[model samples]
Target: MPGAVEESNRRLLRARDAMDRRFAEPLDVPTLARIAHVSEAHFIRTFRAAFGETPHRYLQRRRVERAMFLLRCTERSVTEICMDVGFSSLGTFSRVFRDVVGEPPSAHRRRGPLPPVPTCFAMAWARPATDRAVPEKRPERLRP
Candidate 1:
């Protein structure tokens, strides 16, 4: 990558990191773009190029990941966990959970398990995932 593009990516990553930290609340593309000092289209494009997914999708996935952890590590109710992890709609939460984690939240809770894909393989397995298949937890080549 060229120097300018690398710098822009650094800015986008800054925005992404900020949103990740604050994902348990509302996040808008405009706000994220502003944080990155880029226009919305540019931000979205850069984000996808740099991270391989849309911002909204990434946020939802992160929320679901957090919810899975909390579900296994805590005794929180489904509804409580839904809102606590920033999912505004329980219906949507359940669907996304099933879509990405391969089970309904209740079933996952009952099973006393969470999404098994480790961060090492998070990129290959997260986001556009299945509701029934247990994703192979393969580690990706390490990055700096």
Candidate 2:
């Protein structure tokens, strides 16, 4: 309905694409703002207005999500998966994974087919037929 809004969304999508390319690099507000052709202040506000979270937090969550997938699907070590997902430190990755997935990565693995998690991530790992029904927006990047 809003044609002008399409341009802003395109800008946001461009910003999101750029973010995907340079995710491992430091993604500061000014950098993302420059990519979006918006002022840093406005970029922060606008991105959040459209996506529902701050830039940095979104990035961290994406990394964590990728790590979760790797943990579940691959035989890679936690440290390898941590670095593969752009986490530089084992301690930090473990803490963040625990925070988001709500359990230790090893414990989650040890749980076997039963899976290790609280209701949130467990709900995610569950294979409900309605999986296609959810609409997940790209999360913003993590802060330094």
Which runs in model 2 stand beyond 4 Å of their true positions?
Answer: 1-4, 21-25, 113-144
Q: List the residue pairs that clash in candidate 1.
A: 102-131
For candidate 2, lDDT tens digit of each residue in 1-144?
A: 669678777777788777667666667778888888889878878887888766765666667766666676678899998888777899877876776666778976665544556747764764223212222335599999
Candidate 1 off by > 4 Å = 113-144
lDDT of 1 by residue, 1-144 (tens): 569978897898899898779989888889999999999989988787888777876777788878877777689898999999887889878987887787898887786643566754743543344233323324498999
TM-score winner among the candidates?
1
Clashes found in each candidate (C-alpha, N, C closer than 3 A): 1, 7
Q: What is the C-alpha RMSD of each candidate to the true structure, in Å?
A: 10.7, 8.3
lDDT of each: 0.77, 0.70
What does candidate 1 score on TM? 0.76
What TM-score would every model get versus the actual structure? Answer: 0.76, 0.68
Clashes of 2: 7
Error of 1 at 84 (Å): 0.8
